[model samples]
Target chain A: MSVFITAFRAFGSQVNIWLDTATPAADGAPVLRQVPGWLADIEAALSRFRPDSELSRLNRRPREWADASETMLSSLDAALRAARITGGRVTPLVLRALVAAGYDRSFEEVARAGEAGDHATPVPASRWEAIQLDRAAGRVWLPDAIDLGGTAKGWAAQQIAQRLAAHGPALVDLGGDIVAQGKPWTVHVFDPFQPETPFAVVALHDRAIATSGTDYRRWGADRHHIIDPHTGAPARTDVVSATVIHPDAVLAEALAKAVVLQGSIAGLDWLAQHERAAGLVFDRIGRVLATENFQAYLTQTQTHTQKGA
Target chain B: MKMTSTKRFAVRTALVTSTTLATVIGAQALASIDEAARAQPIPAPTIAPADPVLQPTTATGQPVSAAVPNVVILRHAGEVSAPAINVEPQAPARPSASVVSGSAAPILPPNPVQIAPPAPVVQQVAAQPAPVTRSSR
Candidate 1:
């Protein structure tokens, strides 16, 4: 099998697409090149910071039925499902809250700004039920400013992997929100600060693993992305970072966010109830706490290393 | 009483033969059981010889004794001519459901009642960005 790997910038992060194809490299080059355009299209449809993006346009018009693209509709659907599943812990209507938290610009710009104090009040997000989607008409009515930022990356990863499945087996890793199809892929999860040493490595067999952390995209010293919809403030839970392995990347992303937002104990309990999902939570002190059956995903090499250690 | 003396004697002989055969069969069965028991390695059981009365099962339906020593073996007729000893069918063993000690099934703790969080207090206000003036995309 030949491996065609491509990496570029999109979604304000490094996007990597690895295609294991039977076709020759010459033949596979064109097929591999098409993914960047596809990712760009998805980004245009879903990005919250882009003023001309479809999501931004929809956010501008409240209480009006606006025609949405197929991509936007699907992303909206995934975001709504995420909100419902997390019981409002994760929601689509968190854009205003996110902006109020000093995340009004791209994460790069936010990080560069490094402003310490919160300029806006921390108000709770609008309930997810306020946003309505007319699937048959391909129109969405947003009564509130709904942001697809949380589920957008994982949903895009899922969509990209699905699109590439026909050509060959693919692994789409969008800023650690991954989707693997056709065969199992070994994913090593590392800290955002320490990207060199992986704390946990899991093998994905037609599965996905998403990591949500408070270590990245910070404006203030303590503040980071992944805001809690409940209080509209940065999650003050014990979990510093959480990685969830699930069948669907979108759900995995949601699960990861929920894990960090709810804290380690409640998060582990919640993950335990989901038979298909397993999680690893890093505490503020850098201790690792994993859910049941999470050890099953540890690579044999890592297992041997732990034994020797 | 109505038949001849010959008939009566035949009936007595038949009764004696049946009794003798049943006794022989019972002896053979007991011998076989003893031989089988000797062939197996048996653990020495500590018997404290309680009241010679049988105790009923507990409220939770657990057996008190590990071994049943007073088993009544019933012999069936019509097998007198057969050389092999007839063994009676034993009752199926009942699984114990012990509440006091080691129970087969695990005991789960009572589920805690979940109290839902208070509803979010939504602040009603006019649109902040003041609806973008341009037409919808």
Candidate 2:
């Protein structure tokens, strides 16, 4: 099979689209061309960094029902569903907490300003249940501000991959939340400390993979983007990163973050409670811990590496 | 069991009077409980409004009330069957002992490229930036 690959920056991380087909020029090019535009539209609607975006407008509006676009409504629905399934371990209502944690600006701006080692007090808790959605009217009511964050990327990846699958086998990677359909594609779980080597490689088909880590997007000591709702602060856990594989990219993203917050052992156990979900966690000490069935998806070489290790 | 008519009438009157008095007392007690309950303040609801003004539409464009309930519960198809097992914590491998191919090279080229697979190339993982050399912290 011939593979056509494209990469660009979107959603604060690199996005890569891979289409496998018999004819790259004939089949892949058309489908691939539309992806960037689609991503731009999604980013425009869901980006919290953009003051004029739909999300920002919703956040700024008073706590009352206001008109929203279909994209905004659906993204909010996905975020709520994630919160429901994870029991608020993963929530979109972390905007205030995120800002309080010194992520008031875009990661790019934060990094460029050398804002590391600065910390802020934890913010008060926000509830996802307070956000109300009227799907028919295309209206939404926010109890407070929210940040779609990685959830938007995962949802967008799934949507784009589903659209591209009509033509041929496809994989959409929006900054690490990946969705693949039609055929099996090999995915490598990168070691957080050592990005050069993969701790595990697995084959996925009609599935999604997501990794959440504190190693990136760090602006302060012990401060990261993944916030625990209970504490309303950057999560403090022994696990440095958590990678989850599931049928939905959105859920995978949520579960991965939830796992990191819960730490390795409890995180893996919590991940096991979800049907068709598997996780691999990297602790602060560089030791790898994976769910039992995680090995089922491992490629032969990765299994060999496991045995040798 | 048999009694004179006057005696039977007297007994019946006494039973009727007691039953009426008991009923009156029971009714008064129930009324007082109802008043007490009404006087108590109702707690504020923790959830959204029971009847959300925004409703989901059907495919036929008809408004379907109660279609979107106040609380949405996500339902998965299958039961969670797998129990979490603790895998032995694998130590970092030696530099020369890395088994995966294309370890040093990046996954995507600067420009779009088409290639046939057999060689393992690193694809970007979710929520992480592209693997690049970074300055020491």
For model 2, the superposed segments whose C-alpha errors exceed 4 Å read A116-119, A301-309, B1-137
Per-candidate TM-score against the hidden true structure? 0.67, 0.68
Q: Give a tens-digit lDDT track for model 2, residues B8-126.
A: 99999999999999999999999999999999999986644322322322223333222122111111111111111222333332222222221222111111212222322333232
Model 2: per-residue Cα lDDT over A1-309, one tens digit each: 567777777776666788776653456665677788888899899998899898888889849899999999888899999999989988888888898888887776666666733456887667889889999988998988899984777899888988887778888888788887888877766655545445455778898888887766665456778898898898888766788889988999888988988987788887877878987776665445666556567653222122222
Global lDDT of each model? 0.65, 0.68
Q: By lDDT, who's the top model here?
A: 2
lDDT of 1 by residue, A1-309 (tens): 666776666787656677777745434457767877888898888888789999889989989999999998888899889888888788987877887887787765544454533558988887789888898999999878878778888899899999888878778888778887888776666532223234445567798888887655554545767788888887887665688888988989988899989887678778777888888775554344566456567553221111112
Model 1 clash pairs are none
Instruction: Report the error of model 2 at residue A241, Å.
Output: 0.8
User: Candidate 2: deviation at residue A288, Å?
Assistant: 0.8
Q: Which regions of candidate 1 are displaced past 4 Å?
A: A116-118, A192-194, A301-309, B1-137
